[model samples]
Target: MIYINFNGSLHFKTDAIFTSQNRFAFGDGFIESFRVFNDKITFETLHENRIKASCEVLFLELEKFNLEEEVSKVLIANKLKNARVRIHFFRVGNGRYLPETNQCNFLVEAEDDNVQAFHLHTIETISLSKQYFKASHSLGNIKSSSALLFVLAAKEANKNTWNDAILLNENKAICEATSSNVFIRKSDGLLLTPPLNSGCVAGVMRQKVLQLLQQNSYQIYEQNFTVSELENAAEIFLTNATKGIQSVVKFNNKKLENNIAIELVSLLNKEIGL
Candidate 1:
């Protein structure tokens, strides 16, 4: 498949410019991955809104980026009827580690789909007390450019031969996965998820699961709970835009039965009309 990069009205073959040195630099706008199914993006509208809000929070002009159309064009040009797309937004500058707020660069990557089952490991993450006033926000909730923290953690898990890593907030509570939301089911049949303020991403599937739970009258609660609670949970599953919902069969030697997870999976697949 062919790939294209958008810089003003200029377009380039992705390899002509997408060198390691270029992508590794700091403050190159933001990058997000999307899965395309049957030629349509998964949660297309929400993904669009998310990038737009994130760009705004980053203080970059949306029109200047012209992201949605450019990425769409790349998809069409590549004839990617179904694939994975990585859209990156950047505010370029002259040789500074810190990028300028202006001179944005938008990149579109259409790659083959890679869907696989995932296993999770509970990992520790130090959550710095975020203060928004005198400092610029990095669009944590909105999803933004800074991903080294998650990237490093995921790599750690992989080095240990695990599929993915689960991160905990400073409070020692379950936060989220390196790229998804965490779900826990207690012995009493309570479907528990950490609150958004508990340092977890409000993932698209997470939201959809909550709504499906409510519609189906599942006992879903949003509150802060400890890692110990997860240890005792009857079933554990992770959700995201890509992997969808994956059952955590084990976490740090804690073995779990996938029965309840199977039931929920069946229900979710039907409820979401997947």
Candidate 2:
């Protein structure tokens, strides 16, 4: 009895809600995904704000709809407790490059998930992506449906037998990983990550982790750096809403430590009351 919420209504998962003129034609939308643990949507406020901000950027009007309530409906209909929820928001109308209306339609879906709390994972190896570079533009910060850059980068990483691929901006500065925000920890206990201007997605988990680091009196900086700069880093980790923290063990041939990441996981789970 899989169910989905489409434009404020619940329907079977197989219900058709999009036309070729909409989603498939222009990829004219954005999406947000987050975890639900113990019947609670983690960071619900942050996710709501990000979705609204992204809709504003894309000119998709959400009006007065309640996001959390809608997601709850889908979760309840599907009888899910711990789950991975996704919301797809797209403009509805008739037009080419220009949309006929700014009104937005959204679809909410949830799937059962086994992960109940944030856990630290290890990546054996990672490499820089050579085929594509993330565009250094404001639009790059939005989680738009057009994600070919990341899709190709992930494919390249798998083909090269690397755990993941690091994406660089047009300026040749480290942007982020295929699906997570990048963080580098120096031997001196300093933390560094690419600024939003570096063309990295403004990840929700990245925001929360930064806040936690600051509260714990950790020195952190949102700055752009090149791969050469990483040689001096003592440790590196990636963060995203789904995975929380993933420590990278090797970059090229240099082995990195995960002491800080391991500590952060415990702090993160505690902060979330998990």
- Name every residue pair that clashes in candidate 2: none
- At residue 142, candidate 1 shows an lDDT of 47
* lDDT minimum window of 10 residues, candidate 1: 127-136
User: Which window of 10 residues has the lowest lDDT sum in candidate 2?
Assistant: 16-25
For candidate 1, report its TM-score: 0.77
TM-scores vs. true structure, each candidate: 0.77, 0.96
Query: Which lDDT value does model 1 have at 236?
Result: 79
Residue 152 lDDT, candidate 2, scale 0-100: 95
RMSD of 2: 1.2
Off by over 4 Å in 1: 5-14, 18-24, 64-68, 95-99, 114-138, 159-161, 259-274
Candidate 2's residue-wise lDDT over 4-121, tens digit each? 9988889999877666766446878888989898888888899988998998899888876797789899988988888999888888875798788888888899999978998899
The runs of at least 3 residues in candidate 2 whose Cα sits more than 4 Å from the true structure, single-residue gaps closed, are none
Candidate 1, pairs of clashing residues? 28-90, 29-89, 29-90
Tell me, by lDDT, which candidate is best: 2
